[model samples]
Target chain A: MPTIRVSANGEAALETRDVRVRYGNNEAIKGITMEIPRKRVVALIGPSGCGKSTLLRCFNRMNDLVPSAAVTGEVLFHGENLYADHVDPVEVRRRIGMVFQKPNPFPKSIYDNVAFGPRLYGRPPDLDDIVERSLRQAALWDEVKDRMNDNALGLSGGQQQRLCIARALAVTPEILLMDEPASALDPIASAKIEELIQQLVEHYTIVIVTHNMQQAARVSHYTAYLYIGELIEYDDTNTIFTAPHEKHTEDYVTGRFG
Target chain B: MSPADSARASRHFDQELQELRELLLRMASRAEEQVRNALAAVKQRDAQAAQRSIDRDGEIDALELEIEERTINLLARRQPMAGDLRTLVMTLKISTDIERVGDHAVNIAQCAKRLAEALPVPDVGDLDRMAEVSTGMLRDAIAAFIDRDAELARDVCQRDDQVDRYNDSVFRGMLSEMTRYPGAIVAALQMMLVARNLERIADLATNLGEDVIYIVEARTVKHHAGEVVSDVETEGEFDQ
Candidate 1:
């Protein structure tokens, strides 16, 4: 399969060329080729078991830990293939961070959670400034500044998710991959996370996997619809929501079917 | 089976959508009736019948308001997408077009009342023909909307040129009659106003047809229908 470059300006932050993932005898992701533009949020949406998350994990090489899982094809970050022999998985993960579905903050204090990633790199000279800046970038600074010493688990589900975002930001990753980050929160908290996503695009490229069509429409600049491990359509969010070219995408987004 | 064949999982959402469709059809029916009554009043030269047509426009106005309120409620509550979203947005626009059609009907009825009071009734056969074509377009445009037939909608758009030609001929004939008979100026001018109203009604019907095409095909046919290779040349012909 040929690489599909969706962006016209040749400024893709990440590009996947005919990538597929297989676990033992079962193929979870068929071949998909796409480009994620710099500083723009790209949303991958589909029904459950459509391999959206599996495709996301390929970005940071999180699938390397699975014993039977195998990823094939090229995943390029800044013109360099990530699956090359010499690249370190730990360094790749630090540069391309992830926030999972549920907020899994460590049992340490709020200050410690935000400082965790930076500490892994042997402690920067401006560690306090880095922690405060990451928290502010995640939009959780004012709420957690007074309780920096408090345990992260003591915070609300929404606050804890923001802390996780802050932890990811502390590493100063060039790209952020979020997997259903707001699904576990209430309406107000979900709206706050959405607002944070809109702001974060100014600093980091984002690729999000979401089942909520409305959330995908609201947060992402570009949207790709996946079905049965294949990419059905990918276009600007306004075009996808208003006048998608494919019938399957239209049916899925309109609540007619999955 | 296609995905659209699968019913929306939310039963209440389906109910609300059906209700909106029914109300819009009802309003279309009422507007069509007003045009027929106004044309009938002109044929009979009865001021009382014209007054009746003018008075019924209030009902169309009220229906427009009701449809507006219901559309806003659905948008806020249901948050529809794709086809449902297009349907809701098109409903709001089509209702406005139907309301304006009602207003044009009222204007024609008022012209009928004025012509009834004049000294001599002028020859209005051309005006009658204009009304016939305009009303047929309106009725068929509404039918196209009901059936979601883009072909029928395109046919309706093509018929608009015939109405415009009729309007031009009526204006020229009225001017010639005024020159021949000075005492009949008032009645001739009233007939001219009637011709103009019919022309506007035809334009509104074309608008309705274009909207139906939008809802069905998700492509805009407005302001560029001429480029679509129709039998009629609709470019730079009318201000619309």
Candidate 2:
């Protein structure tokens, strides 16, 4: 309702313009363009194989791990072309860490789990400070502060996911991409991850791919609906739920056929 | 088991909500029309429609109770959130408004019965016009509600001034007529009360329309007609 357009002036935390990703002969993402506003959660929602996850991996060049995969078009981070030849994909991965759909905690001590990132990137003089701060930022410090030396695998799946989040945060990433990070956890754990995601938004720009529309509505500031590898609509979360402009977006959100 | 079945069920829910809103609008429209009919009956000493207006009040009362029950069931069972919550609450409030309008119609009918045997008061042309305008305002106001037309609601709100002006004219004309013909004072006074009741009905219609605008647009329009009128006059100055 404010006269000022919320989107007109801020630096986009991340953006993709006409991005297309392909696997062998199959095109996974088709001409999708969007801007993720700085320090806000942009929830990507769609049915399976809708290219939300494919597009999310594009943010940090995670799709490059798929040897048969190739990406085309721009993936910009803070005005710099992330896909540029001169920009190190390694450095891009560092500044834009990700949490996978499953909790993939390292088989190491809890302190080492979080310390792994800072150590891999060459520890700052404040390595201990980094580990403590990252765990605290991920909202897992109080639960694990006294047991920092315990194996991460000993923790519950939700705790391990939070551990993974703390590991990602250890590198001081400017952007966080989560691919259904709570899908493997119980609802209580999912709620905890959701609560953490909301808290993390204060310091990190986030893009999340989720199948749960209610989760997207509850946690996101903006929502983007994708269908069959194409971006259908992107808008504020409330508008997307209550008064979406596109028929497809409405059908999808209101539980009509995808 | 089938997509069409699911779609049909969803449509059914939407239609149910739509039907509830339409019923409320129908009740409001009928009650408003009765106000006009009661006015005509009073002026012409036509006992038939005056009696009809009194009879119609029972149906409105039934509708008011039915709408309240439906809204309560929706709130209790659907557990609606956000915009849906606003809608159910608005339905409940508008039902109360229309029900009160029905009571006013009945009151007007009672007044008509008393004045029918008394000496005829001179036809104050403005009273009839005021009744028409008030009824039109009530109809359009409820139409604005059913359609969620914020602009139409604002227009309904602005027209309240004309009804008020006519009401004043009715009062002044009756006073002068009473002084000129002291024998007709009692009948004139009853007619003036009917005009005042019609004006109050118009005011209630404005409130109903304003409530709809609030529920639909999430902007409070009550006590803000000047702001709307000014914004319309200076189109470039205010944010839409």
Candidate 3:
């Protein structure tokens, strides 16, 4: 119901048309249709179990990992139907990367963790260049550049999250899907990731799900308010925070939610 | 109460907002009473009544400072959004406007005190009408704020020009009175000053109207023509 501009190029990086997901007999995501603008951050926010994460997973087909889940409708990446029969779910994930809430880095060196994704497709001819670029893009290169061989788990929680982001960025994904990416870290660490998301948007379209309304207001260009598995309102960040169209969105963002 | 709000347990933030609303209403009531008493002082040339009006200006000033502190504290503590955010910001603005109106009342009372000592000038008669219009606007703007009625606030905005018209008439009439009766210069000048204060109050009332519209509709109707084309539809059930 909200009309939003996708990007300067006028092409949406991702879109979902009537996409719904049911885990066994329970519906986690109701049918939701929205455009995710290119090279910008769009935050999905709501109270617990409002399907913010479920909708974010829909973008990269992470929902497919659950055997009980059934997805109906299209999740398009750059105008291509990702659910098409001939399409490979594995390749769909490669082009559309994801970062989870916890900083789940592989038990390897920082360089190895970043290189793990690119190494899977058989090492690129310039693997060093790819790892460096991804680490730099994730805003973690400066912090971990000297210790590229240090175990990722040894890094602080925030650095580990950035390392995970670096891992996701290594494969040169067109879009990034993050599920509560900063909720686990301390405020200082969380602030760094939020700042990183702002920088990342210049090169990649980022979809983030955050329970912190202030974080969503800080980092995202647009905000979507989901309630009871329904997209209640989607609008520009200013409108969502200061003058949302739906009272439900107003109540939730204002911390009046039950 | 709307079902959406009633279903949720009340927040301490809600109590703070309620306290803010009550403070704003009390301040507005004091400002309205000041205008009324000041105008009565002019009509009866009652210096005692004018002094009474002047005495209350400090109370309004203190209330404005208190509102500012509470609103700013809530903004930082609660990080309020949507209607709650608008209400806090508007409270800051409307309190300042009311405070200025309080100052204007003191100015009018000062003129009344001066006129009480001067030779009588024939009544310009416009002061009484201007008094009525400006006071009515001040009263209704606060009502619209309390009631969250954009239509009533818009009506108050529309009445502003009427007070300005009366002010012009009072000035022209005073010009002739001073010219016809050279000895009546002091009285006529004080009367004109009273009219100017009333006009100022009306302008402040118009500002209150615009601030009320902002809170109710999330729209700016300040510089626009009387037609306020804003998204005013904020009604319906909120899906839980």
Candidate 4:
């Protein structure tokens, strides 16, 4: 895990303290102590099987769905330990939403997909306002506002991904964990998602996992490089890309290793 | 990247980077050759050689454009990071410097053509010394870039003062000669311009040396020359 450095005037939104995850006998995340500053994008980048995704899943307890996965150590959300045996995993996920690699929007109508999260938790009196606000925040309202009743699966791959992001926003999440959110899209669509991420950081803290080092360099303020289940280096995105301190991080960023 | 670790996982990327380096070095050598030809024309009063040096500036300009195209293509396709990125950026900048060096050489060669036509050309020994120092700096700067030697680059930076002193002495001597031999004032003024061009070349060479230090150590020693104690002190400050 990388060291945590708070923003100039704000505290960390999420802090992981020596967090480790083990799948049966294989230790996926060796030990990480990273901080996600409020309203900033922190990207986790590494080669395949480097445990960047496993460490990302620890944020909202997504790994709990796997029976073989066992997590130890503290994940703090706004100073509250998330794994203290009393917090509801559902509530944790509601506050810290996720977007997967593939755009897995529901087969329901486009409007219904954005409303799913809010309705599942509790119907608010301003449900229509919530859906509109979420769609607009995701930058997809103008494209899909007229097709509210159309099936979400009918949208393009990029639109489906934005709908997933709108769904995550519908719950009013404080943090968004995205795993390869634009890997399945073309260059244009990937650029749109990256732009939306830049806009979303104003309202939400984001932790993204990506194999695209350039994307991480373009979108994130802080970057953490993981290698073989270990945190190799973490620093400002500019520093990581231009002059990384660790030799391993430098080698990886410069494409010097296989 | 270290010497052994400079090779990338992709051999194509390595080949492209090597090609860029070779192109830059070729431009540097051509610029150096132009300076030599220009100075030789002045020393021998040969108008044809000076005209040849002036005409050859177009080749250096074309090479600059080619280097720029290759650098842009590499940036778009490879998205080079860290040292590779630095190398591409520095290549773009150094190519421009070399092209400008070629221009200065042309300016000296133009002055040489005028001096060859004028009457009673003054002694060009001071001008020769200035050319010798400036061209040596240019050669050493390019050598420092090829070897990735920060120490040698710093040494190049320190030698800029000597070239400046040579330029001042040449200017003062030319002014005294113009006062004594008012009939040959045109040639004296042209020789002064040649010295000025050589001085500018030295300055550009120092700029190239600073760029080399930036590439090798990733620390800028350009304007902060007074603060840098030694090259060793600049090594571990990569975070800056």
**What is model 4's C-alpha RMSD?**
5.5
Local distance difference test scores for all models: 0.87, 0.82, 0.86, 0.87
> What's the residue-level lDDT of A73 in candidate 2?
94
Candidate 4 TM-score to native? 0.90
lDDT of 4 at A180: 98
lDDT for each residue of candidate 3 in A115-218, tens digit (9 for 90 to 100)? 99999988798999999998888888898889999999999999999999999999889899999999899999999999999999999999999988899999
DockQ of each: 0.48, 0.18, 0.38, 0.40
Count: clashes, candidate 1: 0
- Clash totals for all candidate models: 0, 0, 0, 2
Per-candidate TM-scores read: 0.93, 0.78, 0.93, 0.90
Better model by DockQ: candidate 1 vs candidate 2 = 1
The list of candidate 4 runs beyond 4 A from truth reads: A1-10, B1-9, B117-126, B228-240
Clash pairs, model 3 backbone: none
* TM-score for the A chain of candidate 1: 0.97
lDDT of 2 by residue, B117-155 (tens): 788786664988888887887888888887788888888
RMSD of 3: 6.5
Q: What share of the true interface contacts does each candidate keep?
A: 0.56, 0.08, 0.58, 0.67
Interface RMSD of 2: 4.6
Candidate 4 or 3, higher lDDT: 4
Between prediction 1 and prediction 4, which has the larger TM-score?
1
The digit string of per-residue lDDT tens for model 2 on A132-199 reads 99999888999999999999999999999999999999999999999999999999999999999999
